[model samples]
Target: MLAPTVGAEAAEAVAGEEAWSVHMQNTNVLQGHTKIRSPYYGTNSLSQAPQMRQTVSLDLLLGLRLWSGAEAHLDGMMWEGFGMSNALGMAGFPNGEAFRKGTASPNENISRAFIRQSIGFGSEMEDSPSSSLFLKGRQHVSRLTFTLGRFGAKDIFDSNAYANDARTQFMNWSLMANGAWDYPADSLGFTTGGAAELYLHDWVLRYGFFQVPTVSNGISLDPHIWKAWAQVVELERKHKIGSHPGAVRFLVYANRANMGSFQQTLNNPLRPADITDSRNYRIKYGICLNADQEIATGVGIFTRLGWSDGRSEPWSFTDVDSSASFGISAKGTAWDRPNDTLAIACIVNSISKVHAAFLRQGGTGILVGDGRLSYGAEKIIETYYDFAVRGWLHVAFDYQFAVNPAYNRDRGPVHIFGARLHWEF
Candidate 1:
């Protein structure tokens, strides 16, 4: 993606831009984990058996200017393959590109189809660069933007410079996002919704409402819009510290749906300790704090803190109650490879007492679950080095170590090695 250009809007810059833009990207990730010391296993546990797994994704972005300040975009996407243990076993799953809905063959979908209208308020402006998400041209700094249709909530909120993209940055589930936010989405992480963004010179406020799954982590969304939906609000502040730039975002979200109760599951444990046996229409809310700062030229740091009420099951995202992570990203400019990147991050994930107790009673979640439990906070250490092979093509190597896998201390201290290849134009 092109960097944000904040400056005067030039006539030529606007004239040089096309009325429509098309972009294409593809990513392939292969990962393998070492044999783990496991005495037992569950259906949803990260397989202790050592094996290699892979996932591939392709995206095509099309954007067309509808009017002076209106644009429409359609994203065609295809995905194939699976994640380790099918993206199960841990709250901080190690493969961001891997979706739980794996396919033996390529599956296609309209990942994003949205319309955006931006109303500029001030005379000051900057020439924006072309990217897959939005159009490139001159735009005012202080503006009100409205977006509607199908898209991923993560696309609008929790923006981070150092640890956001899975194809190019960190590959862990928690590292790429505020794991505990549980933003509205379907199995493939897309949802039908609308978002409004108010952008001021130094501050940004955004609100979004979207449909959630009818059942926990289901593919189909409930049609009872009022009864099953999600609403989120985020406040962002961009600042400069001693010539360095940084941004902090505070977010809060509430979800309403027919979700299961952890306490209810434990109180009346089923044959398999199924939480869904106690489903009810309830609300789950949470908050998140995210920050990213450019500490020095070519070096940046990022961190995220998130928590969600553990009363209900995770309706959309991973199985996590609380999460915290921080890391550093430094470009290889020091070694003359400006396009290269090196980064490392750590994560801590935990569940509420009731949530953990449910698992101890042989309950299962969207991800983390074992037949029995010896609970502990899940800890992860991940590092990667991306090499710019040439032009838009790049290759990267990644490594991750997990302790107390799936919040079970009785399990691992597993080591995972990975490789990724990505290209875009």
Candidate 2:
């Protein structure tokens, strides 16, 4: 059922009760991907496979007023699902086991339950889940947030644009291409611990550590990586150019993610003697710029540019030069109706060939050192549309294409398709 202008009425009716909101989205999809490999590419050829994937997700927000002007907030999400293509197949050798077992992509694994809470220092308010939960005064100078449960990470560009759960194609593809995370499979990807976030003035910082699977022969449920750490800091100064609604934002991030390091078993299935030390021990620094313009009453255009430098150069492992990569995205949205909207976006990525020299092979593999690994250029294009059928239900469609898919011959172009049915409460 559709309800019109219920904001004021709902606020009045729930004056003394804790406020909460929940959102759920279910998607049943069919995918058909064709990989084109020429003789010049290599000795390998791909099979045209038509795959099917399905998923269900829930996102929740809980808010409670601690005082007249302050509140306590908790947010969480859960995913039960499946999808296609695990990046492990491309993350070098031996890591692709999880992807093969699912008969689908690795991102479709599963999402562990999670929750985060913070107390506001001031009196501002939040009307949507996307709104800041910090109090008015606290968000001005400093605010602190802590999480002790299992959960996924959020993206800097737009929380809704990139996948937060890391349990699906849309999210995994974007993050992997940007070199954000080393998630080969969904269920095996996230850490089991907690994190904290602090905001000070125009700068925001976060530190988090998780319990991940180790490089052993255990199943997906087994934890091994011991510990995974991630840190991100953002600083922004919005400059108004004339009366137009235009602004710029800057972001920086670093992560030490150990996605099942090296092992003689599953991680190094190629045999200890044949196993190569291709682990991705990364130290990364990145920067991004975001700008937007209100072109019309129901339309807007936005663009973002980002670059990263990985000092450790996972490809090289040791004594290797760092690697640099950059990406750009342009988006347009038409909000003609309050409940109905059409959104479209395009993105591209470029990684310098110098990074290829960092790729190393252990023992006696097809390719040794940097000579066997070279990614001249790689790119991906993605677009999706969401239409709110009513207040509680929605539908979406997405398409993706990849070119010069990085990695050796065993992997394909990474093409994908998606459809979703969503309901929110």
Candidate 3:
């Protein structure tokens, strides 16, 4: 049941929500990395040779007001490209836009189709921010919102103003998100689910339930309805530090799916380390903290901390048990380039002891397997500069340096360079 609009008769109420809205965006990313040290290679290993890749994506978003406090949105998306080394090899992958299942030929999909019902609880109203997924209108300061349909879990949880969007911010898997949470998603990152959000002034609480891929990191979602699913809850607080704004979010998520265990795989003598052989319905959970603060005018800093019980195999997201990241985002106003942005971030990713041992015995997850694990933490540093070319066009340059690439100490640090072009209005 939908919550009735409480202040529909007022000018600043929900009735004034947008009648219709349309937005479009396109992006092209090209990246390359030079050869790196590789004593050996496994079924899933970063290549030892120089490599480059390009990816392109187009998105069309439409929104319509359905009733006093309800709206619907649809996303038409097309993507074509491949990640370097087929999107494997690194736990903290450098390119956020790259998907594991890449295609040279263009493909289309209905990435998002959802309906949202908002319940206002206060008379105080404020203008909503611009977004591809949300309709613009005056909204209650304290309200409850319910959304149902196909979308990305990130759309409602673990958000940071400075480090969340790959198109406009730091472009690394772990930098853009808490790698260890492994929130529900299919191969392309979208999932079918429902979420509820309760906003009260500077604080909010959110929860979501989503479907996971039937097979680890596979594109197809589970067919058995709620049998294979994931759930997440988050609490967020917003406040002013000095005169600048800041926010912190704490998230916890659990997944129950047909998954394998690292320790079990290693214990099975017949099959030295085939995790899939021991698949069973199991529950896995994790917690993540995300924070961002605007320290000064046009200058903001962000950080994320994450951990998960690593006994079970990674079901969808990359295999990471412990993760931490810190970064700075600054506008170029000091240099008089008001529309330019410069950002840098660093990420550290690691697996549990049992996970390391499993890999040591030649087991593999979604990414990062060297056949024989050297058991070193994967570390990465990334920087990018983006400048506006026109009203709806922008271009960026990016670079990344990684040590112990793919958790193998035998491999030397690697350097990757990239460029991106984006258009949206």
* lDDT score, candidate 3: 0.85
Task: Determine the C-alpha RMSD for candidate 3 after optimal superposition of all C-alphas.
Answer: 4.6
lDDT of 3 by residue, 1-425 (tens): 00001011112234555577777888788999999998888877888899999988888787777886788988888889988888888888888888777888998888889999999987898987546776668789999999999988887888889988777777888987899988788888888999999999999999998999899998888877667889999999999988999999999999988999887788898534898998988889999999999999999999999999999998877878999999999999999988899999889999899999998888888887778878799999999999889857789999999998778898858999999998786
Put the candidates in lDDT order, highest first: 1, 3, 2
Question: Which lDDT value does model 3 have at 179?
Answer: 94
TM-score order of candidates, top first? 1, 3, 2
When 1 and 3 are scored with TM-score, the better candidate is 1
Name the 10 consecutive residues with the lowest summed lDDT in model 3. Answer: 1-10
lDDT of 2 by residue, 44-103 (tens): 112234444554444344444454434544434344434343212222111111222233
What's the TM-score of every candidate structure?
A: 0.96, 0.60, 0.95
lDDT of 1 by residue, 1-425 (tens): 11111112112224766478777888899998999988888988988889889999888788888999898988888999999888888788888888878898999988889999999998999876777776778899999999999988888998898888888888998987898998888888889999999999999999999999987777888999999899999999999999999999999999999999988777783667888788989999999999999999999999999999988888898989999999999999999999999999999999999998888888888898888889899999999999999868889999999999989999998999999998887
Worst 10 residues of 1 by lDDT: 1-10
Please give the distance, in angstroms, between residue 20's alpha carbon in candidate 1 and its true position after superposition. 0.4
lDDT of 1: 0.87
Candidate scoring better on lDDT of 2 and 3: 3
What candidate 1 gets wrong by more than 4 Å, as runs, is 1-14
